[model samples]
Target: MYSKKVVIRYTATNVDQPIICQLVKKHDLDFNILKAQILPRREGVIVVELSGSKENFDKGIRFLKEKGLTVEPVSKNVSQNNDKCVHCGACTAFCPTDALYLERQSMKVLFDAEKCNGCELCVLACPPRAMEVNIF
Candidate 1:
């Protein structure tokens, strides 16, 4: 199966729509919602991992764009800047996938890029701004 992680932005007009459901039902796609913060009549965002046939995946993404939603890949890479990281463990607290964690013995922070879902929570929580997202 083809799979990719994506970030979808919703404006107030489409915030209440069952867009993800449509992706599944109409485009034969499967998705895992990694993170979401949506409210009625307001801008919202969702990070999701979608999997399906390549053609179906393309159709599903096109459908989202047709609905006036902004869709983009989560990131090409998510990395930690060791030069800037203090290893305070702040980013670890916000990492739902355990991609960032504290190494108790060394008192250092470690990042595992494979486990990250690209939700961007670590980027927001890191006080030192060590966690970085490279979209390209």
Candidate 2:
């Protein structure tokens, strides 16, 4: 199974959220609303985390696009070589979802992409620049 994080930007008064939510729920997918900010211009930006099978993920993205909602993909940076990681806790500390953690014995940091909120805090906090976020 695969998961995806989606960021949605739209007007606050838009009633289309329920439609999107219904479609996602129909697929038995799980989602979280991370950030919601009402801008001075009366628009809003809503960040959401979605987890499910690849089929559901693709369907959800397509559904949002068909509804004319702006959708962006967000996830942890895994492109960096693991050997380059210093196992520093800086990135873990900034993870909004506690997705990064170090093993008590090996001291090796593990990343849980499913738990990640795709906030990009870990990427910015990494001193080694190991964490990467691909926004689409």
Candidate 3:
């Protein structure tokens, strides 16, 4: 079996809740929240990582776009600046995929794109807008 991974990002305002829920239900797709920083601020980005059959993946993308979600291909390049970071853990805490982590000794933030769902929660939480999503 072959599978493809797609990431979707969107603000709370753009989200179509019912459509998202319905797609999840109908496709039996695995949805993982990569970030949720915008929840508290009433505006945030959601990153969902979906892996399934190619056909289902395509359908899922269409469904998300129709629902008003910004869907895009995940990119490896991430805009992160550790110098400006304060190690507040906001990004780590908000990461739904456990992709961001803090080193035990240095307390530095790290990112794993493979595990990232491309949700922009970290982007929304960063005070300096350090985290950037590269949609291809």
Question: How well does each candidate superpose onto the true structure, as a TM-score?
Answer: 0.63, 0.52, 0.47
Off by over 4 Å in 1: 76-129, 133-136
TM-score of 3: 0.47
For candidate 1, lDDT tens digit of each residue in 11-76?
A: 999999988898899988888987788878998888889999999999999999999999987754
Clashing pairs in 2: 77-132
**lDDT tens per residue, model 3, 1-136:** 3343445555666543555678878776767655443454244455556666767777878887877776655545455676676767789889888888988988778877778755567889888767886543
Candidate 2 local lDDT, 1-136, one digit each (tens): 6766667766645533565577677776788776666565455666677788888888877877777677876653333348768998887777777788888899888788767666677777889887875432
**Model 1 reaches what TM-score against the true structure?**
0.63
The alpha-carbon lDDT assigned to residue 24 of candidate 3 equals 73
lDDT of model 1 at position 34: 77
lDDT of each: 0.86, 0.70, 0.66
**Which 10 consecutive positions of candidate 3 have the poorest summed lDDT?**
35-44
Count of clashes, each model: 0, 1, 3
Instruction: Name the candidate, 1 or 2, with the larger lDDT value.
Output: 1
